[model samples]
Target chain A: MGATPTAAVLDAGNLQQLLDILQKQNYQTVGPTVRDNAVVYEHIQSVEDLPRGWTDEQTNGRYRLTHGKGKKFFGYVHGPNSWKKFLYPPARQLYAADRMKHRFDVVAPEPSGIKPALIGVRACELAAIMVQDRVLMDGEYIDPEYKARRQNAVIVAVNCTRAGGTCFCASMNTGPRVQEGYDILLTEVVDSHGHYFTVETASEKGRAIAAQLATSPASEEQLAAARQAVDKAARQMGRTLDLTDLKDSLYRGFDSIHWEKVAGRCLTCGNCTMVCPTCFCVNVEDTTALTGEQAFRIRRWDSCFTVDFSYIHGGSIRATDYSRYRQWLLHKLAYWQDQFGVVGCVGCGRCITWCPVGIDITEEARAVKG
Target chain B: MASKKKPTLAVWKFASCDGCQLSLLDCEDELLAVADVVQIANFPEASRAVKRGPYDISLVEGSITTPHDAERIHKIRRMSKTLVVIGACATAGGIQALRNFTDVRRYVSAVYAHPEYIETLNKSTPIADHVFVDFELRGCPINKYHLIEVINAYLNGRKPNIPSYSVCMECKRKGNVCVMVATGVPCLGPVTQAGCGAICPSFNRGCYSCFGPKETPNTEALAGWLHALDQRPDEIVRAFRGFNAYAEPFRKQSEAYEK
Candidate 1:
């Protein structure tokens, strides 16, 4: 129950209070810190573990970190590293075998002590977690490792009061503000007056954390301030896309001649899908060791753009760049919604921002849809 | 009294994801019964318990991309009573056929640590290129239900009821709008095969042909329409030369637009 909201500014002194609250609850704190010049998600002990005075500028084929105005908790869109890396790990040994007296028994790996209380998570990133949830947790075949990691974790979502030029969460219907999936949601508001946050609890775990913290009841005025700040961020959003009847739009455009145009620029490098939070298609490899007795199976992320992703017995069926390019567009915009009811894109703009050639999906969609 | 003979079933892999075989395991309820019906002769992905082949039916995944693989398919053809190539990889050489456009040497060097350690053909070919395949299942990832259909057809001696029509037929059947004509979304449903139930264009995106081209595809006409949508000739060629780039009609069309 989100009774009275809480208002607090952890100005240097309150930094210790934040750590003590997390330590008291015995939840491992995870937040952003400078790793290889990029804000990477990792474990945190205190305020020093946070990415202080660091912000990000994102656009197609460009991502740069800027010196923040002052002390800030979380200020990044996303990085090469995602929560999925820690949750579903890039390469994980699923099970180990120990031959008994008669047959072999499977032993599952124990959970890594990563009960992370994610601090300063942006709304778009939180939406990403939900999209991944539909793929990993909600699917008929649940990833056992992902289940363990997600079940033990706590999510703290924050509304983005600032949107750089590359963001398109509004178009993707993902965010400018955080929504229901988070356990706790915070909105950052900075002005000439001061920098502060308006925090709300979504889940019971969030409520428990609030109880442990040295926070007082928030006034209605502070709550209004959070709403106004969120609205301002919404107005300043970087991009917008007309998603109405998009599925039907693609359905009728099968031979619309737009794909050939797109195929010209699409390099098929797969950077888009690699960074995409919900693209769950994977390729499995079965490797046999020298002894033959030692063999193991592994799963790795695979993209439809890759030629090998669509191989056939005789050869590839979609044997042309046009077809493969169309397949990805269709899958991302059309078939994804058909299968999952929700559009595949979360509008984090990682695909556009990370694409080597700066092939903007929004621009592509507009060209084809028009 | 004569003992009831169980049908011997084997799952095989070539150059693809183990998903299709995993589909058998995914059928948790049917798996034990599947194991019971078939001797479960071979399936490296699931169980290590290898019962030697000469299998009654071999469901092969992936494609022939090397000299060794080409030779191996022949041995498999000899051993298997009924051979079914599953997934796009097995039927169309998968997405690896993208290498068919460029030098395989360059590709191997680009992807591998040591080109000397890697062994590959000039082109990634399909199971049908080297040997007679009993049946070829389509899709970047083959449809599991259709997979069961192929298996059932072999078990009972019937032709698989797979439609060879365009995706447009399915879209019309499902009451979906014509994406290309209606919304101007460039899709590939017109000439592409009718598998995947016309799922992509039904949404807001274009159809990337995963099921490959249909019988006597009018790829030339399709390319013309694509050009009208402001696509450059090279892009149009690249589109057709992608996942199923080695397939004849698409391959020819892609080459027609080559830079």
Candidate 2:
């Protein structure tokens, strides 16, 4: 609508001006903050709230916070909390019931009124969100709650310049550089020209916000620096899962005996699915007051690795540890393709880094593929 | 419909710590609400007034560790329309089940000056091992939310929605980075059941397997990884022999590693 979104250079000092514009629009700005020894998303009030000079070291089953080389915010890779916690939430009351003498009156919980401006979103996370959108919103039965939150939200994406020890977004072709799915995309560049962001607007709203900021047309050299940053990130990936016929290979390896081999080390902990950006299974629970006068229905995140997730009328379907592990891996890599037309993994590698026993998804995939 | 009678509920104990039963009492805010809907037929800890059962629902805690408890459970089962076992003690024989791997006579002699004064069983077994259990809630101390949900499901005549998955799921959902991969710590979260909300991993420690094994656990694989991490086989065996030593999958895994 306004001069067709162009590339502009913004000084790092003016980053607060961009956040202020979103705040003035009545959007609750949410961004990364240093909490519990990791970068976690919280309601951020200013640029100071962002995890500046803080990066992380991540490996299979391990993570540590470390200081960055410079005053770089968003230098760390993905943490445990994804944007899903804001949109879908860990727990939510679906409805409540008033118990009467004869029948019950059901009342649905009101939709969340907060409109969040999500800042510093990663490329793989954007892909993960898109995958979730397909599963939760594009389906026949849309999740009304997720729809409301997602619709009112804003996205400010950050292009990755550094990859974590567990990162494989390059292999998934989901990150290092963000192609789309952001209102405003920012590439942080630090050199002799000083610390600044190469900003590009994807939508009219983004352009309008950028227009309000003190910015200049990006030079050829600045753009090159931004591209090189992404290129370095791609080259620095610590893990890779070859996706060449990966879906079919996983399907074929259902009985590859590798399942048992991996299962032996697996504690059957659902840590991978929990840390995963795309895993979205839930279980519903109903609770009543002691007087039977009130009742509530709650929906909480569930995982396939649990025994009750597959509980049938008789017992359980996937009763063995190997079978449960196999179901989860196959569903993420193969079955998701058949069901969702996309692989569930965005190669963020949170699952690998967070596994209590250090079970690497890429390594397992490669083993089965072989 | 006007004269519908409230369902009766009872609580029973056996051979472990009373933590699981205390979890029910710890529902301080929800206790009054739960009490209003069901008749408290028998709960020695909560009320001194004991009512005879034929209880609509009986929540059993602890494991079978003595000949008297072994026989008493059968009688209790007969009186309960629905028998729900709560905690690792009742569902997987608790930490006391460590005796299952060793001789009880030796343990009694080692702990007591007069061994003849103590009368114990050769093995500590779960309630499910003795009689049919309608449902089993896993955890060192059963989650209060889950206890409510299980009771609600039974009263509503529906399937309880407790997950049998690993603690890994909870750890991930909580956004806690993996201690094993990042710190090279050994965690039993992979093979352990989900219910405790992945509490241990959230604190930057490995899962202690307080909830016992998930539906089907891969302890061998976990042990192999522990071995790779430079953990001795005996340490791995001791790891599995904790709270739920008598749980079949864990017991078998520990036995396999035992020299």
Top model by DockQ, which number?
2
DockQ scores for all predicted structures: 0.02, 0.49
Which digits, one per residue and each the tens of the lDDT, describe model 1 over residues B118-145?
Answer: 8888888889988888888888766666
Compute the DockQ of candidate 1: 0.02
lDDT of 2 by residue, A1-370 (tens): 1342558999999999988999999999999998767788888999999999999988877788888677987777767678888888888999999987799999997788778889999999999999999999999879888888888888999999999898898888898788777889999999889999999988777778888999999998998899899999999997888889998878888898899888777766677777788999998877765445688888888878777788779987988878888999999999999999999999888887767667899998899887
State the weakest 10-residue window (summed lDDT) of model 2 chain A.
A1-10
For candidate 2, the TM-score of chain A alone relative to the native chain A: 0.97
Chain B fold agreement for model 2, TM-score: 0.96
Against the unseen true structure, what C-alpha lDDT does each candidate score?
0.70, 0.85
